[model samples]
Target chain A: MDPDPTIAAIARWSGIAPPNEAARIGLADNAALITEIEAMRGTMGFEEEPSDFKAALRDCREPTP
Target chain B: MNAPVAVTDLASLSMTEAADAFATGEVAATALVEACLARIDAHDAVVNSVIRLDREAALEAAAAADAARAAGRPLGKLAGVPMMHKDMYYRAGRVSSCGSKIRRDFIPGVTATVLERLDAAGAIDMGTLNMAEFAQNPTGHNAHFGHCHNPWDPAYCTGGSSSGSGAGVAARFFYAALGSDTGGSIRLPATLCGVTGLKGTQTRVSRAGVMPLSFSCDNVGPLVRTARDAARFMAVTAGHDPRDPTSAREPVPDYEAALTGDIRGLRIAVCETFFLDGADAPVVAAFEAALDALRARGAVVTRISASSMRAINAYTAMVSRVEGAAIHANWMREHPGDYAIHLSARLFGGYAFPAHLYVEALSRRGPLLRQFVAEALTGHDIVATPTLKTRVPTLAETDIDADPANWSRFMAVSANTRPFNYLGLPTISIPCGFDDRGLPIGLQLAGRPFAEATVLKAADAFQRETGWHCKAPAL
Candidate 1:
């Protein structure tokens, strides 16, 4: 696959260069992870925020003995 | 009064045992410190576990502890026990190299809150231990500091990024050590080195004054010889610190008191899915035997399905990678050559992810954790797995720096332990059995979020029935 253009754009806009060919190849696993996360795009509700994880942990805790 | 335990045996005692001996005047703090120092002096050259050894300071502190005891003054919970933490935990005015050359001379102005708590409990600070540079890698390969060798066999990998904590504790250099876990840093080392390590629920312990690799995934915990030691260590360190506002405010329970050794009727689920997929035969045999041991203790074991693990693993990698890249952005731009080649490459990939994808990874954490708990843990009090899906690997085989072909084995080292990081549940790894190569295998026990006591209870009960944790490496 061609190097993901969006990654290059983000790296350029952020003032950091993209990984070299070897390093980019090393990221093949991460590329698969990105694809997996991308597959779940619409599953999350609009109101959901990262902080909800803390609440979820508390809510799911085993009842205090 | 009972006869005093031999000084040569002091280093072999568990953290709680050593502390209790000190409390009852069976052994002086000085003797315990001396015993640990002697062990390090004898074996650390082979293990390469210590980055620094505060020999004089530890001796002085032990003397002070003895004086306090002689004066009938109150002693802290861990009074007189020796510990060495991963170098990332800062002690004011001391250099915490964080296993990286870039920070070799960087000194912090404050001591880590966990260290302060450990001091209050009377644990001696022997020095800092080696780790993956910047805690970036899963295997214990540090370019600045030499690789931490497994005490069992010097040629094998110690597992990382909490390399020294695992190897040192297994080598009997100290009673316990602090290890930071993000993507199996603590548990992997614990598994590979054959000891007990606990990563409490996310934010269960304070991160103040500790190094940060990932804000969301980082957890501070202990690597020790036994589950009871882990329980006691957690009791002293697991609570909110005002300095770390992100730390959970959940009431810390009496973790030690929870080890009643009666695990009868406790439900355990073994996910016959992602955790066991591609598991080597020896690892599977060891893991099955571990489940049988737990079953003999009257614990119920059920094979269950967990479909969310793939997502959990993916999100975990995405979030930690993005956060780690952002954390190291300025450093990478300025001192790019200072980091190891493998580390730079890993962070380079981190810089490639889109911003929204990072957000999506974070945003989906709650939902995935909810799904996991519902599917795998709703009926089970604990979920069990092989801490490492394969038997221990030799350093030569997993050294990515020497050859990039080693990447798959290096990354696979943390496969069984990484998903739990994203789920943010309380998990512990204890020695189950050894592999065909005589390397140790670990049985992992993960419980509901914040249920550290239940997790500790089960692990302690298992340790009571098995001699795995007591089998020290022949250094």
Candidate 2:
């Protein structure tokens, strides 16, 4: 089986997030993070992402145990 | 008569030698323990490596071991060896400051699994060692407790966040000690202190009850006088733990058996791109010499294909930052001024790690870890590289507030070591040589997932042949 959605998404993003961020926020805010994620997706070529990846983010953002 | 009874001399006295002498009624554990306590009294004033010296308990433990042997009870290999634990690890009812005022009086009822394992193995618990506050900073300086000076050169850094483990082990106050690495804490200090450090594969050793740094990256391992000593420690401390899900369920190997030092046909790869670049002349020279030494000792060494190191470094940055930030997020928000200024931005910054980036960095480690385990080390038993890339810098030089060049170089030099933590692989750093300043430099050998035996074999062989790891800084 393939890796979990959130993990795979992280893998995708791990390739793209530029090291130039002044801070993590700056890193996230800079188009660099998204750009890298998108680029990695293009390289391996994932057309659609798992819905759970987005849901996991919502849970992490909310932190509801 | 006894070389002034230095800690270095004591540590240089092998655990095997000491244990044998003690068993044969030649030397008493009480005598060795007293020697360490006396040395701590004399040189610790200069090193400041030990934060809390538990004399009463240490003597009691020593006396008990002597009693056990006298009673004809077969003792463990590390019987009567004196050691310390980094303050980040909880000692029942003792305050584990994590080097910050935030938890100054915070004590735990339970002890760390590694410490429990050490106790079971028959090591004398000398006391708690110093560290970078909250295991956040890699440099040894602590804003709250005070800086732990390098034993080789008091002015130079001992490296952190395992500052005291490195220094205490180096100075001989203890034969071996425990250090945790989130992002190169154990290896950095091991290299800087000129000792043997094993950052056992993540989850290879239990992490239950230790202070958290980065949950994903953090691991408990030995910082010792030699890899053999480290292996002795690993043999006892390793095993599946019901308390920590991350702890491996695999059976612990015969670390002593792995130490025969015969790597005749072992496939060992030397990483060129990230490890070899941007290193100082002295470090580069020592590393090349180490490669030569290993080759002469009969092992294959070749450069493996490396991806963009920046990508790996970037991943380490986010994963550690986000997780570390998460750990301290509460304490930091509660008391901002309580933390070292250098760690402040890094921890709080984890929250700012766009939710996507944090998850992305966390997720990214999966494939790479599996692939490296499956392919890169397919034929290779172990991989070799410089543990660190620069000569040891001074604590005064790395104040983050004081020297940007020193801080950046400090961060960059660790590029060789941190990826293993990111990949959750076992890595060992063995002292390779000394620079002109007399500080120790280390060479890192990383092994496949759960292949700690190979890592131990390579390190133990290199150490036995070179004797670099046995050399101690005159305190």
Candidate 3:
């Protein structure tokens, strides 16, 4: 039988060697990470700006008593 | 004036206390270095926390410090204090393996900005401490270097990728050690080892010349024996660094001076949703005790809800995974076997993330932070949680490569910590109590962005009311 297509596609696209069975199992378990990412897909508006590298400093000066 | 304390007693002094002794000329710097070296020699065999010990150079530096003090020259706040750092921080003409075989002999010409800051503050660099490979893992099981055993108990984990920082501090081998937190590395080890760790608001400290894990989440901080020590360490190391453009340019506060021990009207919110979900019973008991301690110090504690945190915690990994994979793209392609199996597995999945998803994760950071702040911290000064939802696991339990079935246990170590990294807020972890197994549990206090002073002040107040931070591991 052929290898799992999901694993094969990941191997081919990444150009890294195919992970061994243990590694493959761990990778397969990242479904929750993917699900979270998918849920936030369009939650952001275009008007909303991404965080800047200097955002920390800006937020620091955000005026708190 | 009284006579100088003995070198044997130096191990018992906190970093702030030791530095004060140094400033008063009560003890020679040479004695401090020798005492720490002796402790490392006697205890490090079991802890496996140190990667390198620059004995000769450290002693020489100590002598120089003594001479400078005798000459009546100005001294740095950390003058004569001995410390080792996580192996990932690069120093010129020194080996920084970063707990990875691939970089065994890698030496960078420039020292990390944080190292330069510590050097300027008169801190002695004894050597490098152990960490997870590429600062990747949270439970401190480095396949390249032997796992860092907890000083409290050799069988349990030291918590990583700042494993050595935690263990070495608990062992009293050094006053403080720098631990980088991408997702709870510093805080986890601090909690597990019964020390204190502070992860300032993201970019509060420069990351120039340090190893990168996730560009967005990486933070530089210290794991020390007391919140006061962490406060002083942050004051010295925080602020803008031209060397690191991402470093915040905010004026550094006198973190040590901020510890007034009065937290009157300090409102701390406890979210009963995601943070406390499935938390271990013992951990819950310890966290409530910590709240009581804080309340005794005039801090108002209330329960609140931040429903968005569940999604926040879940999405935190995507940013780090994608960025870490990109950082190691070349190495992953060429020397895949050089990495530990579990680390390789985690990085492998990073390659599977879609570009838009990576961008989405990054772009949504601001909105999510705003949402979380509005939900959790609108009427509160800080949010409190258990640093780890569960007790510290054994090295055997978290060694995923040894048995992949342990993945959930391994992943759980950072569940409470990762969300703060995502929110880019200043957070701290301090020992609260021990679990049924006698492993240390940590209380986490997170503040509004760049409100590190508030975080440290509250922590110091709690420390004043409780002796948990004063309890040393029976190494």
> What tens digits encode model 3's per-residue C-alpha lDDT throughout B345-428?
888878877777677667767767777888888788899999999988999998888998888788888989998998889999
Candidate 2's docking class is incorrect
DockQ of candidate 3 relative to the true structure: 0.45
- Fnat per candidate, as a fraction, reads 0.46, 0.03, 0.35
lDDT of 3: 0.87
Q: What share of the true interface contacts does candidate 3 keep?
A: 0.35
Report the C-alpha lDDT of model 2 over B1-475, residue by residue, as the tens digit: 0112334444457555555556666666887798788778888888888988999989998999888888989877678878888997887888888877788888898898888878777888888888988887777888888899999989998889999999888887877888999889999999998888899877788899899888888889989877777777888898899989867676788887878788777778876766777788998899888888888789888778656344555566668877876666556545766666666644544554566656666655655554555545656778788887778877776775454334454455456777878777789998999998888899998876667777888887887678797686787
The full ranking of all candidates by DockQ, starting with the best, is: 1, 3, 2
Residue by residue across A1-65, what tens digits does model 1's lDDT show?
23677556656766555444446556765766657666866654333544598999998999655
Give the C-alpha miss distance for residue B267 in model 2, angstroms. Answer: 1.6
> Per-residue lDDT tens digits of candidate 1, residues B88-195?
999999999999999999899999999999999999999999999999888899999899999999999999999999999999999999999999999999999999
Q: Which runs in model 1 stand beyond 4 Å of their true positions?
A: A1-7, A18-22, A34-51, B1-8
- Strongest candidate by DockQ: 1
Alpha-carbon lDDT of model 1 = 0.89
